[model samples]
Target: MSLPSYQKAAVIEGTELVIKKNAFIPSFEKNEVLVKVIAASVNPTDWKHIDYGSGKTQGSVSGCDYAGIIVSMGEEVEAKGDLNLGDHVYGVVHGSSLERRNNGAFAEFVAASPLVLIKAAKPLKTIAKGQENIPSGPVETFEGASTLGVALTTIAITFSYYFKFDFSKKPLEDDFLLIWGGSSSVGQIALQFAKIYGIKVIVVASAKNHHHLKSLGADHLVDYHDADAVEQIKALGKNHIKFGFDTISLPQTNQKVHSAVSENATTNSLLPFNPKDLEDYRSDVDITVTLAYLAWGKNTKVPFPWMETDENGAAVSNPGFPEACKTFFKVASKALNEGSVKHIPITVLPKGLNSLNEAFDLLRHDKISSGKLTVRIEDSA
Candidate 1:
């Protein structure tokens, strides 16, 4: 297959993302693979990078989750024998990142590291026009596949590495996991993974989303808007909630989630928070944050101040995270192939890269809920 020298992409211009019709097609490094991006999904972090972080510069491409075909591979990737050209794959990338400026998923082609990529068990099914909100189950559509990369990586690391769960053994029946923002993309997937491991789940979400979350295996649902939301979680879990994940991670949400957990329980957040802020709430509880970009095993620069950085302001590398992610990806692949895992439903935005502006507006204003915003690259043309 012939590769193009230039392609259309969503590029950062000032504080907003703009469609560039002639952005350079990035070259792959020795440890990377060049992919022809078929579909990409919008993540909160994609907009946050531009709004809250200084990492993205003008002309940097914008996005993270993508499902596509491998068009070319580096020598190291080829020698590994784990992936190949024409293989359908989905994975996360640090879009609009300071480290990899032009290699974002919202483009015609992307240069991605093979370590963070997952080979799909089957080819991605094309979604028909006006049927974007397909029923959620397994990995099938490119739109659905695009939503899995970021959520899966975060769940894999949160469970296997941070929580230190032994996948060989099922969790005890008494064990409970609390998930804040249960209607969000990450929260929904976390609910499923926790159930698959035999752990009961308590979800905090809107009242309208309870039925959907219940279907996804949430044992208990607490409406976050309720005045007694935290107390509800505490009562439902019988104050024995041993694990908690705050997908929303606002300071208020963190406090509520922390307050709901039992003493000595472990809680993880999507964004970094100062321990002092939560010290008044619960000192006995352990609090940590997960950055999925660390699974790439590279130094990163995140917007939050809680992230550790060197004199150059780059985050330190976690040498062990990449291998841990590799192991967990195998586990995830098995679960996906067995149809035990479900991808989040998505709303396909028209005009591909051109639709990103609207997508960002919807996400920024919190107009979207319970589903991801996706774009088919072919629609750009």
Candidate 2:
């Protein structure tokens, strides 16, 4: 069980972590798992946390998603359930665990909580349920599976309650929904999820990404390029739409959502569905969509099942979030294995132990989008 002296790892090294070589590889608790990272993907949270302290701090690393082979697992963890030594796996972290206090996935090996790392085989179980189009094979390579983490949070955290979406049905002539930043990683998956949920989507995003949104099944696309993006949106609703998710968390996005759902919304805003507070009666439409911001103040202004807050000023857990995550990953795994979703075509840059910085530079310039960047570190099998 000898280890290399200098494994590849992307280190934040300090505030504004600029990737450098010689970062550390983390060790695990008894039940913890050590992943020989196969292909780690850079997500927005990865950069934001590195640049902005948006996630719980470890020491240097700030990435969160990875796909790879398991080299080690805590004794208790191995005895507890399904994970086996040498198994390939992928998952997202809880964001606040000290085990990962500043440790993120931008490295060759990450010691992660067993709870966060689901056995890769689980998602493949859905094929037997008659979910056609899913391949009857191991879930495709890591990046394809790597992108599922944030998408899982968006769906599980923000829209689990609304999962009752009857995709087979059509929206009424006046039904509407406000989707902020439809082009984002989280928004993309949510749109795909929403398609199954039956919402008439009015998506907000940069004009260039509108086509991508349309491909994901957005009903209407609003270019955020214009100063009056919200105004344009509200006019389309003529004030009828309510319900939204602010994946972007921008000040303007907040206002746009408030307007799109508040102006002329016809769903009883006064009584309040979850009944937390009331006064500004968009009274017609009680529900307004907002992404549960982990960085902002809690929104108790209007009530719906989705709103929640924790002591850390983060959105409290949604009731069905964990389950939704499990389900979506299962779906994503199936899609990946079966080829329903194509991996964003790109080079598999398995750069061993020193390429972490290179990955970060590419991400910083917005050089990677729609395509994935990856790294591999172990031959556990």
Candidate 3:
């Protein structure tokens, strides 16, 4: 296929998103695949990069969470599995990393590690008795699958990677988990994964979302707006909740989560918090932060399912992250097909990539609630 030398992408211009028509389409590395982005979802991370200008340099493309078709692959991808050119996939990339100038997903094409891309699976809907059935195409629309990568990957690391929870076993009847801000994209999916992994969960969110979250498998609900939100959770679980995840990661919510879990429990927060900011919590309670891009950069020490230690007992480089991401993506894709994982509601913007600035502004000003903001990119194919 003859590809374009220049592609359209959204880049940060001071505090706004500038759609550049002549952005370069990133080339793939040895272990990477180049995707023709069909749908791209905007996350809070995108706006944070725009507003704070952290980890960004001149000409860095904006946005992440993409669903697309594999237009090309490096030499190594064929040996990995069924992945190939023209397969539809969705996953996360370090879209705004300054380390790679052409890193972001907002562009018409993106080069992502094969480890981060999950081959999209469509579910079977036909019911024929006493006969074999075959499903066709992706069960999720491009926009629906677009919502999975960042939210699912981060929460997976929080529980499966950081907390070291075993996903192979079913949740014990007595086991309880507590999550704050349960209606957020990460929170909602986290609730689904925890439930499917065999743990009962208590969640704190707005009362209006209570019924919706409960349907997603949250066992107990506490309204965050209620004055006794912590007390309500603590009273119901009574030190039974051992694992805590704070998706909101606000100072007040952190303290409340501290009071809601068991004495020796560990908690994971989406955003990092300084130790001083959490002094009110008991010293015995361990709090760790989960960053979705930990495996993307070269210099990170985040643990993956496949990392190994050197002879000196120091953790070696992230050779296994690609495999780890590939493994988790398969698990998540299965969950999605079987209805164990549900896609969050999304609000799609018009005008393709040009609508990113307005979409990001919705997140920046808190105009969005519960649903994710997505932009359907015009397929250059």
Candidate 4:
């Protein structure tokens, strides 16, 4: 297929990406594959950066997490000689970030790391007893492959390092996990991984989202809207929370985490504060809480500081730090193809670069909830 010089694109005129008539299609690096994007998904990062400017500016179009076809390959790709034109592919990365960093993908063509692209390669086997391997095979769809890229990895990292699970052995069936904001994409991935490790999970979401969370393998679903979330959680179990993961910010997300955790408390955990009335003592209950985003500066407030603990027994201040989840991302990709996990549901938009900016508008306003918001940048066929 011959390349086109100018194409329909989502262009950032300033803070807003205005759909423009003339734009550039992406090209692949020698180590990359050129994808004719068919489906694209948006993460919180999508709008968080766009509207908030918390993220760097996008030079061209912005959307990440895509599923498409390998229409063209670079020299290294051809030399390796496995993937060819028309193969289904999917992976996650902010197309916006790609553009800013050097190779942008929010257009007709996106060049990607062929070897590292998530879901491009199919799963071969469940290996390391704890991890899954991606070998060669009939690849999974972009929607499915795209499910895991970041969402699953976030969950896996929490399990492997934050929760301190022994991958050497199948996770103990008796273990328990609690996930706040269970309906969001990240929370949904946690639900799937909890099931994968044989960990029973309790999710906190609205009544409307309860059934949906159950489908994602939530053993217990708590209603955040209810007046008695804490009491209800206690009624479910006196004290059996082995792990806790919150996807929302507290105060605003409002202590659903604190209330649920005060009831269940990770692994019979204990907290340390000055002895109340000089009559308090410490115990070895062994529980920890992990929130995913780091407190880069003092600006980020942590909820549970009194909990006597560390991240995997190491001294650490922040809970939701990045950089830890890369391994989990790989695990999630494997789980996706192995059929162990599913991407949070998505509203797939019509295929075309023309619709990019409008789709981004929906994402930027928090207008979308429950599932992922996605658009197809190019026709796969």
TM-score, per-candidate, Cα-based: 0.96, 0.66, 0.87, 0.68
Whose lDDT is greatest here? 1
Off by over 4 Å in 2: 1-7, 15-25, 29-32, 54-58, 74-81, 94-99, 113-139, 161-176, 235-242, 262-338, 341-381
lDDT minimum window of 10 residues, candidate 3: 126-135
> Per-residue alpha-carbon lDDT of model 4 for 59-98, expressed as tens digits?
5466556676787888988898767777776654444542
Q: Global lDDT of each model? A: 0.85, 0.54, 0.73, 0.56
TM-score of 4: 0.68
Q: Cα deviation in Å at residue 331, candidate 3?
A: 1.9
lDDT of 3 by residue, 1-381 (tens): 678899888877777778888888887787888888877888888877766654344467877798888888888876775687778888887776665667677888888776556676652221222322211123366776777778877875677666766676665577688989898889988888887787889989888888888888888899998998888888888777788899988888877887788877888887656656665658878887767776553443222221344654323435344444555666776887676677787666656688887878787787866777666677221
RMSD (CA, angstroms), candidate 1: 1.5
Model 3 vs. true fold: TM: 0.87
Assess the local accuracy of residue 56 in candidate 1 as a C-alpha lDDT between 0 and 100.
40
Worst 10 residues of 4 by lDDT: 293-302
Model 2: per-residue Cα lDDT over 1-381, one tens digit each: 566655555555454444445656676678578877665556655555555553334355656667767887789877886677777777664331233443456666777655435456543211121221221123455645655554554454455434233334566656676777776666766666666556677888888878767876889999888988868887776655756666665544554565567544422111113322333334444453323222112222111223455554434544354454445555555544455443333334544334555666787787754444544443111
Look at candidate 1 and tell me the lDDT of residue 206.
95
Winner on TM-score between 1 and 4 is: 1
User: Residue 220 in model 4: shift from native, Å?
Assistant: 0.5
Q: Which regions in candidate 1 have their CA more than 4 angstroms from the true location?
A: 303-306
Error of 2 at 152 (Å): 2.1
